[model samples]
Target chain A: MNKIFFFLGKGGVGKTTLSASLAYYLREKNKTVYWASIDPAHNIYDLLSLPASPKVQKIEAGLWVEEIDVDRYLRRFLEHIQEKAQKVYQYLQILNLDKMFKVIKYTPAMEEYACLYALKEVFKKHEDKDYLIIDTPPTGLMLRIFSLPFVTELWLKELRHWREEILKRRQIVAHIKHVDFGPGAQLEFSKDKVFNELNAQQKDMQYLKDVFTNPKKTFLILVINPDKLSLLEGKRIVETLNKFGIPIKIVLLNKTGHSMELKELNFFNDLPQKKIPLFEGPFPKQVLLKIASLWVEDAYL
Target chain B: MVLKQIKDFLSQFGQGFKEASIDQIQRELEEMENAFALLICGSLSGMPAPPAFLSLCLLPYMERELKIMFSKTIFLDDKLAVWSDLVEL
Candidate 1:
């Protein structure tokens, strides 16, 4: 994709509406756009007053929208793991995988894993699109999603190292036995099933880390209302991205007309900022189409 | 019969002219395999397990180690009882 724009903010910060406006603008500019909401509390359909679709839907020419069912993605992710387990370890079927998955379903970071899975799918499938816009989940989950790749990479790397060492020792045993001791002894480090699995996971995590940390290909648009809490959360988002070396391209000061003190937002003074007028009710398509000029051109075009 | 027997002896020797059983190496190899299994799937025995997602796939490849673990656990539970049963009913 030419560019990936992630609209990130706390809940009720108009992430859905703002991202929709950017998607509309990009399509208006004749760029092929794929807009998706990875948030569980998706409001993209409501804001546009369009029917909710679990799959990607074409909206006129050069535009597609999807509201991802993250839970479905989670289930699919587990199925993928089970399928791999079957192929890599044939006897895996003896274990009641369904029961194990039921436990994994509630495991910490599974939601984040699901979101990462969905994100990779979108990137791979829609690479031909000129611009991809993702309306991210609220702050906590979205941050975790962005950082999941980096954290997972660290873990899988250590696992791979230990697996190689195990294989090395196994080879020593096979030498003395003059027989391949079960399956483990027969494996070279490169040829082992477990080592290969770990290698694949490491590669995927590194790819995601590259995508998130690359500033030119990916843009982080922080959406915050002109209020104390939103500004504080926005600052934290910026700081976290900085820690990851991922640049925040612009801060969209949403709901500007409200009398929330701007003094709190001095944190954003160093970065690019754009103001969008506070509207009274549901965002009309006409208004979204018009507001595109306010920040889309300045921030993206 | 003498010629056939000589041929058979030669074939057996040729098949593993380099093969030899070494007890020390055998024991060390067994130890490595057991440790590998214990580290990866330790959670099955109420030990601190690796993240299930990461280790779940390797269950089949570690089948030998797992069996060893179970046998060892059983033996540890009542070694004397197991030996007494050797007398037969």
Candidate 2:
């Protein structure tokens, strides 16, 4: 139920720097803020000069920063799976199922699922905060993460049917073995445990979708530089968000070198026009502050 | 103990699972197809994972998929592999 702000764009557009400064500015206004980075590259530490730890680091009066360590999260998630699977294995007397599950846990989406699970935990546990600002990964990965609830839902449906069939098959096997069909039967063939955890995860994804799709609560600010590639990328992002039904609240053009001519500026007119002045120097605290002030002025209006 | 409680809680939704509609399944399949298409296109174009432009194109389909996936209750551990595959996208 808290307001969530996402600073998203292609990489190298100062999304992290902008997000950090904005969080700082919001804190100055006496609002409790939790600025989290969902980027796998882990640049928030270097940008903010904070230690690489998951616990919130107080940067100002009411602002705190945290980074999601995907690997660690994945390790923990896999460990949970291993623990649960071990319980099932021990109960069923199945040999080597644990090893097979370990291999499955190492698959590609495992890390992403772990990261998302971490996001769900944070949202659920950190309810007292006023603002939650997210520094998402670049557009593509971030979109996949954002859209995961949708994609996973389809898989879940198919999986439900498949699981039921598997359960039925297990029951037949139990019958053939003349095993007593009693309370232990539930433990032997139940899909309820796995489904419940997934349901919880889907709820988290739904929370994100609700927040993201709502213009009043979640604002997607696209960050861009004044170059052909970045500008084109920004335009594409704008269009993509619209296509996905996620609102794009504003576009922040960062780090435009002072040498561009008037004709070059014409390229930006094609975009949904909200422009912030370009800073000339490196993205130090002062420059970040300036950007943050501009963002606050624009975002509030 | 928490895990057991969670399982017991989810078993309550098992009845609804029997009532899934075909239209919902078809709609979800379409969404997955679109997402897969977008990912393929983005990868071919060398675009990053959250390709801004293409993701916009994929968002609605993605949203549809989300709605379908979450409406009926499914457990987490069983679908971890499916989720892992999608996240890799």
Candidate 3:
């Protein structure tokens, strides 16, 4: 079984419900489950009938639930950068980091970075779990989150190269002038503080990249409604995921009805497909458990 | 005595050449630093930059370069020079 499962779909397509049900299902099988909602429009807590603000809470003997507090997580991410910066910058105390951060929080793509950082942290923290279920954001943002590591890795490579070139030049000049070029010049490029920090970030990104692309370790389950719009979005998501080398293990047709003709759509032909019946009432834990019982045994098999 | 003079002149020439090369390299490095700062923190100047969270992550290591970039005078008349630097990069 894949160690990690990501539930992805359009908004209001029952991704949270299906993912929560899967977590509950896994718990019944005596598997350790860590279920997290990484979507900005978080609904996992609401679906599970728990308080919304809990970062991580015990659901049962082996299942844990978390609704990521994005604001707090973003602040923690900034704090992480600040701590690393203090170690790297000799005069970090002089910089008005708070003021700078106030400006930075409004910049484009900051939310995406924060989301990715939080996801990475959550994934790292629960590596020992038998199953890690992620309820991702809506299609567009979730795709961006998945693609972030690739873009980040590319930029980091270029940045590392540029940094090394600059350092090499500095060392050469120091040698010619017979001057001590400071501690940075004395150390190998990998040991240089700036290089080391970039390297650390690269390592984190690479770990995620590997996990995301490896099918045996990670399974992407696309949750879709039987409606046309959801199917369209799911198609695009599947294509993008394929382009990024993330294997889509299953296409979940949620809120499915007797119009079995929707199953014949060409988009669903490529992957394993499962249909979920339309439920009439609120999806409480009991309802989810009943729904889960249908597929828990053979869902991944 | 003549040989000694030649030797002294050669040493001075070598020192001057080294100084000039260092100066040119420093200028090139400075230009690269400015471009890099703009790549990350261009939002500060109303130019589109990479994600602020990432820029913030890199800002600590780039404090010195950014300071130089911010302090350097911007000249409207230096369009050609700016073009050349961008082309070189």
Tens-digit per-residue lDDT, A36-95, candidate 3 = 988877877677666776558887899888888767877777777777666656464777
For each candidate, what is the lDDT? 0.78, 0.61, 0.78
Give model 1's TM-score versus the native structure. Answer: 0.83
lDDT of 2 by residue, A77-167 (tens): 5566556545544544544654655564565455556666777777766678988888987777776666666666554455445435534
lDDT of candidate 1 over A53-145, digit per residue (tens): 888999779999999898998888788777765664565467777787888788777788888888998898999999899999989998888
By lDDT, who's the top model here?
1
* Model 3 ranges off by over 4 Å: A80-100, A178-188, A258-264, A284-286, A297-301, B45-48, B74-89
Query: TM-score winner among the candidates?
Result: 3
Determine the iRMS, in angstroms, of model 1.
Answer: 3.6
Over B11-77, each residue of candidate 2 has an lDDT whose tens digit, in order, gives 8576355323332443354344334433424444465343222222222223323333343224445
Candidates ranked by lDDT: 1, 3, 2
Q: Worst ten-residue run, lDDT, model 3 chain B?
A: B67-76
DockQ per candidate:
0.24, 0.02, 0.36
Error of 3 at B38 (Å): 2.4
- Model 2 chain A: lowest-lDDT 10 consecutive positions: A181-190
Candidates 1 and 2, the one with greater TM-score = 1
TM-score of each: 0.83, 0.64, 0.86
